[model samples]
Target: MFTGLSAFPLTPVTDHGIDEESFAGLVQRLAAARVDSITALGSTGSYPYLDRAERARAARLAVEHAAATPVIVGIGALRTRDVLELAQDAQDAGASGVLLAPVSYQALTADEVFGLYADVTAELSVPLVVYDNPGTTHFTFTDDLYTRIAELPNVASVKIPGVPADPGAAAERVSALRALLPASVTIGVSGDPLAATGLNAGCHAWYSVVAGTLPEPALAITRAASTGDATAATAESERLQPLWELFARHGSLRVVSAIAETLGLLGHPNLTRPLRGLPDHDRAAVTHVVQQLELH
Candidate 1:
């Protein structure tokens, strides 16, 4: 079972290319922190911005540094063939699994989405994680579609983004999905803000962004929630409310990049060009939250 926290680190970038040293350092840190798994080339990794070669290199580097820790590499692409090739590359790179989100230039139909996974599953030998992050992909997965995808040969887990507006509703949704999925299909929640609620509602794992930079706090919430301690989980969530507000105001990519820079996790928190880091004011806000939480 793919349970517990899966840390998705920001892909550190330098003028020349991927900051390989810094990237390895981040992965090694997460491994030392004992995160259940690590995901490279994920949304935060800026996978879409990189070319095929860059993505492949990032996957290999992550797998190498991850050592004993399992690494799940994001293989999402707009085209079916591209996704298939990336999955094969990930498997060859020694990744434990591959995560796929139905990212499309045009909105995809249900059958088209199903076909995409089916084709990839046919090619991939590693476990497949269905990433239902409609916020970024603009491709929502219906329960029927989820069930269909989960039935695929190598589909082992689904990363469900939380419904942030109403955590109660999100918890209920998690419970419903839990009942709907097969016993072998692990239900993990992304959307850092909703992780505690999702776990309390019985999610087996947390696909976390904040954990990439601050594993301790993220782990605290997940551990408490996983053990059925709703009070402790809620408390930790409340403590992170300020940071969550920033994430809501700005996207996590911006806030998390800023936090990473503030903590000196990267040489600089430079994301791929065209996607800049947070402005001065927002960055100050992140710094304040990090200090208040004593995350640094």
Candidate 2:
């Protein structure tokens, strides 16, 4: 099971295609900073925006740069075939695991949700990390359904969006869910700023979008919290709080990509093809937040 702070890098796209050079550089930087894991082509990575070929290239770049560190590939899509295809591609691309969101073509019943998971797991060779980011999928995961999915073969972890407003409560909920899951399975939170607090609350680890832009501070937060230094951890989290707010302030997947572009981490902010960039005002807001954080 992967644990601690795992950063999710933005998948930078140029006018032609995936910017492998920039993407690899970002992954190398994060690895050097000692982030626990990295997710290639995730929500922050703009998985939905990328075509299959681009997603594969991004995953391969992340795996290559991550070296021994675990690299998770986001494999959520509306179609089961697409999800399964991406899952297989991720495995072939050397991803250590895959993160899947429940099918959202329609409002799926719990049984349908469980079946979709089972189908994906059956086709997958690597361990699966189920994602419960309701904000994106428009469907929330019930604890009972998670318990059942955890019992399936190759289901090694669960990824829930950390309730950042009340991390303690989120952590408690994670701990309670852990009890229902198999002892071998890990509980991870996708809430970046709350990672330190979530770990303190018994979450085994976190998959964070903020880590992509600021690996040093993000890993510092993870280390401080994981090692039981609440004072240091809280301070680190506070420092990065400004960046976290950007995710909400700007909204959607575009903001994270925009921040990466402004930082010069990516060659271009062009996401996939049709997705737009941050407006001048929002870009100014993001730039201001970035300057405030002063992450190096």
Candidate 3:
């Protein structure tokens, strides 16, 4: 049911706790920009770092700020119960859906992954968007596995990254996946400014971090691409690529979170427990990109 662009609003965490004002501003800006929806607690939100309570609080506040826009919380946890609980919490907080990943610690066989999805889908009332970030999960969903996963009742979409990030290759991958997935299940693309190309290849929507800081430009690119205006979309994407590279340089989470923090946006700069702050060089790189983009 999602289309166009959905900005993954950064979860704001202050040293004390969730920073309501800064966090709200970011969501409100996206809402004002008319982004298709908003996703919270995704990989880019540093989901693994926050405690259960912090995550729920972030979801609740983000939903409130989102107004009529759909709020989908990303549930990436080691425990199925934790994932289910977070999904329930998201539902309770009025989330529109949950984007879930495979179990974190151990890779499961295709059957096991399907069964785990079955468990989570059974417990969640809201729609589930399967998040396939093999880079982090270290497990890629095979075409057959995705076909099976698509049959689950509540599963509505799959978020695949532009892993290799080459326009043509990514398009080929998306096209192949689209052929396998049920028409009802929307395919979402992440990473790279392939929004235009992905849509051309049948991606129903994009989960864009670019939209987080530059909603208008990001959406403009999506709209251009959606309308078959690749020339215009390509131009905007070219402008966005350098900033995206900055994030890529320091890892997605660090650059995205630090960008939010630098802009006086997000709540706390705290990452999940283990991952520390961005190194100074990387932090400066993000600042330079933001400034270069003139993203105020």
The lDDT ranking, best first, is 1, 2, 3
lDDT of 2 by residue, 164-228 (tens): 44766866677788789999889887766567777777777778877876778877877887788
Better of 1 and 2 by lDDT: 1
Could you say which candidate leads in lDDT?
1
Q: What CA RMSD would candidate 2 show?
A: 1.8
User: What is candidate 3's lDDT per residue for 1-296, written digit by digit as tens?
Assistant: 46788888766665676666877888898899999988887776767778889888889988999899888898878887788888888899999988898856776778878888998898878888999888888887888989999999888998877634466786788778888888889988887556666765657888887687568888878898888887787788888788767765676667777777788765455554566668778788888888988776
Work out how many backbone clashes candidate 2 has: 0
Model 1 bad stretches (over 4 Å): 163-168
**lDDT string, candidate 1, 187-220, tens digits:** 9989998788888877899999999888899989
- Tell me model 2's lDDT, rounded to 2 decimals: 0.81
Please state every model's RMSD to the true fold in angstroms.
Answer: 1.3, 1.8, 2.1
- Lowest summed-lDDT stretch of 10 residues in model 2? 163-172
Model 2 CA lDDT for position 26: 88
Task: Quote model 1's TM-score.
Answer: 0.97
Model 1 whole-model lDDT (C-alpha atoms): 0.89
Better of 1 and 2 by TM-score: 1
